[model samples]
Target chain A: MLIEAAHKPHERLGAYLKDEMAAVNALISQRMASKNAPRIPEVTAHLVDAGGKRLRPMLTLAAAKLCGYRGPYHIHLAATVEFIHTATLLHDDVVDESGQRRGRPTANLLWDNKSSVLVGDYLFSRSFQLMVETGNLRVLDILANASATIAEGEVLQLTAAQDLATDEAIYLQVVRGKTAALFSAATEVGGVIAGAGEAQVKALFGYGDALGVSFQIVDDLLDFTGGDAIGKNIGDDFRERKLTLPLIKAIAKADAEERAFWTRTIEKGRQQDGDLDHALALMHQHGALEDTRADAMVWADKAKAALAVLPDDPIRDMLHDIADYVVARIS
Target chain B: MLIEAAHKPHERLGAYLKDEMAAVNALISQRMASKNAPRIPEVTAHLVDAGGKRLRPMLTLAAAKLCGYRGPYHIHLAATVEFIHTATLLHDDVVDESGQRRGRPTANLLWDNKSSVLVGDYLFSRSFQLMVETGNLRVLDILANASATIAEGEVLQLTAAQDLATDEAIYLQVVRGKTAALFSAATEVGGVIAGAGEAQVKALFGYGDALGVSFQIVDDLLDFTGGDAIGKNIGDDFRERKLTLPLIKAIAKADAEERAFWTRTIEKGRQQDGDLDHALALMHQHGALEDTRADAMVWADKAKAALAVLPDDPIRDMLHDIADYVVARIS
Candidate 1:
């Protein structure tokens, strides 16, 4: 496991697709430039230049290349996906009132929320312009629907915040909104743009959807167990009262006293210093973390299984490896 | 002017297009709903229900109908325009740090800036979905370009704020971003969806663009003169340090002492009680407001002249009146 961790599947994928990824980076820099508003580029460069792992755009390039896409528009689609992701991150920081991201001061902190909001809108518009340049209405439709899903999921998550009634269904919905919709769209558009068969497109979409769900589940779990791996302190989600997978699972199993504790800490935002440890203990008592990990493994497996209908290629193997790597983080 | 103001041309346009506008409203209300995110509807309804002039959507409907379009998609186009307008307004309130809009507490104030930003994005995505329903790439292209222009104009406005160097050219660019881009997009998409001739579409775009410029010039002029008619206090722009047309024109003609006052009051934002009056006096002394009015008249005339290429319909006449009525607000 240690040897495997030294060179992750995603890193391997990135190295394999290095040339294509560079094109996406070039396109992102080119499109993010605002000829008049220097601040637009400034704010964008602050975030886009931040080490975002480029996982989402890599998913696009991989999906297209895996499906034998040879056109220039995979670059366009890859850049479009990154813009949407970056734009969302900008707004998410403002929405979450975050101070730092990826070990750097957030654009909202360095600049202000106003610049973040306006620049985010600019990037989204630029994404729209990029997609429209493809002139593929079906691609447009898939992306448009995905955009709506993402926004709806965000709104759903906001309204559900701190409500003890948030269950697995709501958790899944929020998960999809926060991550999966874009992943699925990134892959689906790649296949559609490549003129792949409907079955292959569906497989790609399914692969991305399950992979995103698994990725986020691992993120949530790592918040409790992986210490510094999640990029911050353990129990940040607990402090923020996000009812992610493990918490929801544990809460579903809570007894009367345990329910009271959750209500006090999460529902009322009255988190005490030792509360995270207590929550972790309760999750263990209920095996909630184990259950959540189990669920994530299932999703990772589903993601791998979804790719079975696609062509046999090294890109396909890397995508399969990415799915395996997602669950492997928490394994 | 008093006789003409008894029933505004916009009111006439609304009356003539009432049924179609009703359809637009219904579509807006229906699409603004979220199955999962109730806050979206809450924030949207707050601004969407605020007694906005509904002028932008009406431009779309009028343009399409005047071009002899009888399809149901015009309703979609009109609703798309409104969603874009509402979304921009929500973000604008956040950007301006505004407390109230149209005498109602803004969405950002009523709920929070987080909800405002997310809901605004939801509405934007919703607008994209609605435009895609038309299955017209040209319409999408026009709206996408306009969206970019609007965001760019806004970023430009942000960077240009309180800078005495902002000229009439920059002011016009900002005006186009803040108001005219959407206006022109609203009209242009309407014509495009109707499959109108290129000449007619160009005329429609020209009309909306000029009218929006005229409307905003009147709005800026009113901020200096029309106490409360703009739904806020006079000199609000002055207090906000916005360099509108009148201010830009007056700044160019400022004497040494007047430049000091302008610098201290606007650039430094160190306005005293009598600063607004001094600013107004300076504007009058230089005929700044008069020149701005002259500029508004030219755009209004241009708006009217653009309609000359269109078929002679009552909708066109009312559109012409809407232009005349805009300048009449300040004349």
Candidate 2:
């Protein structure tokens, strides 16, 4: 349906990629139908069917197709990626003790923590069983590595939370581990499972890694940018004492007054009603948001450049467009 | 060591196997050493050094040696198995909200729930990375399945707790998933990594499964029969409403009043002072403990028979002695 919108002026790549993503979503839903635990389907469907972007799974499916896969197993691979993603979200909600996700009530809040944890474990098991049925040990290796990396990332993020010494290097490591690893793995496995050559597989992973970095940087940037329609409020990262790119930059550029304010608000994690506005003003005054956006654009450009080695196809064009779409919102 | 005290009567098998199992203990301690995350080495040493029969890891090492594995990776595998077991204990303590393990404060109570959960996750990741370094896909597959089965078993046990209708069938499934799966995977992968034949692998798995089942049954029996020096007061499983072998057998043999007692104590999960004594008396009067001991002996015998299929060696003798050791108290 959004393909029609893609033809319009200033239309985004998501509009063009809607149908393929919907196929991935449908596949995910079908595979998530559990027989033993009735609660599993209910809880999993609640998160899976929630109207968030199926970006990761779509990336997996798109990568496989771009590598000239004609088999139906890509559907299973996409579903597996989505299941692992959804399961992580369920556990994350419990771990973060957060009430909202993707602008909706989190699973732990809606159901209970026990259900979130147990159901998350169940989905993980189900995901493994699904991958095992593929009989592709390489895929198993990739996905299991991704699962372990994702869990480690969450643990790192937990440890890094509210710690002011969390510099750019550790921050990048946290982001790469938490977000980029799965993205890279998803696309890389897609290429591997589709029987792509080593070079193309490497390119796909590079593209995915760059795209994921761009996506996360843009997301982090939006927290300070104050875009109401995008569900990002002003200084959200600062309010949470999350040392995003802009904040780290701003901290480096802090004047005496700014340093004092940041030390009290960000470092001490003590914020007031006007603290968000103050933080946003500091970020703008220091040009940190602009710097973060520029960094994101650099990654987006790298993602597009990685496609130079691949053979031309509509999927390649779409991937390039998707990379641009990642940074488009920040601009 | 208890080997010296318990082996006084059986001078032959006891002292020799004691030295062998001591090697297993030394291997476990050596492998559990960590350079990162000081808490890891600390929390792990707390449990690994806690006095218990190193039966499971010994089974793994013995199986590997019996299959002529000269490689040092078996030590890593043995430690990996123990780490997984310890990690699960940490998470299980939090989930069960238990206060005591080995008559000492649980990690949850001692360290905190957060430490328990995150440390459990850390050990899990470490184990995954360790197995990956093994570069044996079959070993990875076996261990991954064991992990899922272990989690599923824990969930199943959580659901089955205090549910009186949880009969021997579901009980056995839980036991298989929780205990036998890991035990079998430990021994099975030992044979696998050693490049043993399929028949040998299957026999090792069978031996471990029977050994684990018998060991768990004896543990449950000890909860009812063993005195405080063993070390808790009797009927710990009854107090916890765990529908173990003894309880399952007693539920079957129970009459109307006995059924009512179980319904109130286990199904309703209500217990008063002296209820443990009453439960033990019922277990005696109904011959439930006797039946559970018989079932455990049958499994021990089956384990010995499974070992009979393997080639005769000192490890084989130790395997047989381990099986005998499992039910030695009950017999």
Candidate 3:
């Protein structure tokens, strides 16, 4: 399955799309600047320079290159996607009161929530400006809808994150909104910009959607079993009372006593010193972790399968591997 | 000026553009809904339903009507402007840690900052969707730039709000960004959509820019002397340590003792009894309040003068009156 590889899929894709990514990075730096507001550039550079893998923008570039088109607008669209992502991350840190991101102190921590919120807003507006410069209404439509979906998904999560009634269906909807919407939009806009056929564009959207879902499930899973390699504190989501896949699955299969335990710890927000360990034990007892991993694998497979309609390009191979690598962390 | 009459200028414009304003209100209600996240609508409705005069959207409608625009997209643009304003207000409340707005409890205070931030983001995305539906690139560019400027202004205010070094020039730049940018965009887009000539569009932009500057100057003045008709607490800006136009003027004219008082109260954040009254006395001592009012009158005159290039229509007259009424609040 080529899943035994030691190197990262994104790094390989980054290498392949190095030139386009370099253009995207330059555009990002250029657009993030404000002639009047120096604070905008300051706050933005702190997050943009923090050195996360530029995966989303790369997805856009990969889709464009794979679609057999050469154009300048792809760089604009790639920068747009990255700007949207950075904006969302800045706002997300404020929403979650997160102190750290990508192994560094968050922008909200370094500058203040006001800076984070306002700078995030500036980036969102700047992204719109970049997308509008493409002069493609379809791309704008896809991105605008994806953005609305992303915000809606966030608000949905705000309400449903701790509710026990949030089943797999609601969780999937939330995941699609917050994470998958932008991912799918990134790929779909790239194909649309390249004047790809309807079938290929749809395929790109499908691939990104499935990959995003797989990506988020794995993220949630790693919050439990990721140890130090994930760069997030283990059980951080548990402490936040988030209804991730494993915990939801465990709760679904809980017996009376286990149900009481879940209700007390999660719903009531009454956690003791060893509650996280006990929650892990319960997830193991219910095989919830394995079931969650299986679900991520299914989504990853679907992501790979969606690429069958696209042309057989090297970029496509990397995209396929990216899907596998997203879930391979759980293996 | 016709603004000397009993009725307010905005009320007159509202009556003039009543039908178009109705459509904008309906569209706003329709677009603000989140089919999945009920919380979004709840938070949005709290702010939308609060009777805040809806002046920005009215400006768009007035500009379009003055340009003889009969198309439906003007309504869309008006609603777009309103949604953008509401979104910014929501975020501003969260950034300011504000407890009340427009004589009502703020969305942040009522729902929570998380809801305010997310809902604000949702509305911003929705505004983009609405503007994109118009299929006008120029409109998109103006609105997008305005949005970026608004955020930049807010961030600038975050840093400059309390600093004694903030001068009249920086204050004007900040005002042009936060307030005048939107006002000019609202009017410029209307002219662009209505097929107004380049001269007319530029004139509309100039008029809105001047009127907005005057409007904001009067608002700053009212924060000190407003007898409760302004729907905000007197000295609220002072309490928040905002370096408004009046305060900037007073700071400019401060002597040794007055400079020490300004430093102690504003820069050092040490407020004691009678500080508000003492600050007002100093402003009076320097004739800063009168000078600020004179500056507002000059801008309002400039706004009226800019309208001289446009068609001599009733809507144009109303806009001229709006410029007068904005400063008349201080009279």
Candidate 4:
């Protein structure tokens, strides 16, 4: 029901969000336009213009309005969240040695790793400065914790990657750290800076966290069972040897032959040309992709459940729709 | 006169400091010891155990007592300062791609760059958690500003390195950002959390800033004139193509041939063996090292002047001696 309303009535919500986010974007462009360092703007704009969905900032704005926030600090807090997100992306590309991001050459690849690392540090410093301008110690506490969690999640993922023993519990931790932490913090701080009550704040945080977890699970599952080649490639995780939910489930369900195949391809990270087809077949045989999708829908339902405490509003319906869109790509 | 106190009868500040710093070190060691991740302690303690005077934490302790602080937060602040310092060093080594740090293999070399970067992030997060536990917003502001300044300083240093046109002003900016920002913040927070008056906090910041400036100048000067490998390698800055004080000062006073030598060797990073002697001779010929020493003394005197507002105490006298010790190697 929420999904149907979101699809039909969300155009108005989108328009309102576009204007709200434009202000945040304008502030970011203004702050990022460093006169002293010409190279900073050049590199920072390269990543900023790469066009993320601006989901985090939008969450901040949405949560702020939902809680009856009347102050202007939410805009600043939203911008702060966006900066931290961008800074982490810059650093993440370098850490992951990722050559392409958003289907464009990453800053690390286009420039040098040195510039990426240093400029990321500059953005981080700038983000903190922006947060300080808000004069909210609670906001700082939230953002700082989010940053630490993001970093810990990254370290955990790094260690967990390629390890055969990584189970769903560790997988969940990594996904939460890598994705949910920022999402929850973004929405949580929106409520906090708005001076929302504890229940509203906690509701918003739960909504963001469940939505984040669902989003990541869908992304992971889409790598296996995406209906179209344009939507998701087959066995991207296998080639990278990333132990995602589908693969972990398949491994648990694998017979001797399938186990041997995974041991050769996944553990060794030496997949052959036809390995993608073989992996997909194995996943289908075990119904692992379907299971992962079910898990994601469960989280989406949990996300929708979190809004029970909030007053009925169009933005709340849009939030539910966004969670559906996250899983709809799998269909 | 403060330099002479090193040889004269006085309070046992160094021995007393050793005991105080031991407590700080114990706290750092305890925090760094990760149960699930043994690599955390291994990498952190490697650098923590590497011998340095723990000068930053010592400044925090000394400044706290000088401002009549008797609280337990000083210990936390001291440990927080050191954690920040160590985190920066870990990242700096990765950025510089340096092999040796304080005569030991760098964290990057010892445990790989990924480990160094992630572990550095861990320490940064730990430092934030420690400061948050203090529950002092002012102290948090002081430290968060310092973190930004430190990162910015590193970026400035990176940009300024290898640019021969970098002047004394730029060099001072780099030095202030990279080295002195933390020093001032460390002491400023010490006085602040101790509930010192505004004037006292300002004085403490001034003391730390001056001492930091003198300390960096002495470090630069020692790279040119320190004998017997007792100091870091002569012209290590030159080898790295870093535009340190002596090099910038020498360039200012250089004749055409000397300038050409710098352009080819330092700027181009094309120095061969025996260039160290030639470079040292050029420094002497232009009185660049001597000029740098003059700058150090100016900062030292300024540091002593900062103590003028403080009540006369043995700690104040010892503070003066410490500033003197920073440049003592050059003398």
Q: Interface Cα RMSD for all candidates?
A: 0.7, 3.4, 0.7, 2.2
Q: Tens digits of per-residue lDDT for model 3 on B1-331?
A: 5664657888988998889999999999999998899999899998899868898999999888899998999999999999999999999988998887887989988888888889999999999999999999999999988988888888889989779999999999889977999999999999999999999999999998999999899988988888545458889899889999999999999989999999999998899999999999999998999999999999999999999999998888888888888887887
Query: Please, what is the whole-model Cα lDDT of each candidate in the order they appear?
Result: 0.91, 0.74, 0.91, 0.81
Model 3 clashing residue pairs (backbone)? none
Ranked by lDDT, the better of candidates 2 and 4 is 4
TM-score for candidate 4 (chain B)? 0.93
Candidate 2, superposed: residue stretches over 4 Å from native:
A1-39, A70-73, A110-112, A129-141, A226-240, A255-273, B1-54, B71-76, B101-105, B109-115, B226-236, B254-261
lDDT tens digits by residue: candidate 1, B81-107: 999999999899888998879888888
Q: How high is the lDDT of residue B80 in model 3?
A: 93
Categorize the docking of model 2.
Answer: acceptable
Give model 4's TM-score versus the native structure.
0.92
Q: Per-residue alpha-carbon lDDT of model 4 for A66-118, expressed as tens digits?
A: 88888888888888888888887877877777567776888978877666776
Fraction of native contacts under 8 Å reproduced by each candidate: 0.84, 0.10, 0.81, 0.27
Predictions' DockQ, in order: 0.87, 0.25, 0.86, 0.42
Q: Where in model 4 is the C-alpha error above 4 Å?
A: A1-14, A33-36, A225-236, B1-23, B33-38, B227-232
lDDT of 1: 0.91
Docking class of 1: high
Ranking by TM-score: 3, 1, 4, 2
Tens-place lDDT per residue, model 2, B188-245, is: 9889989999899999999988988887888888888883344376666788899998
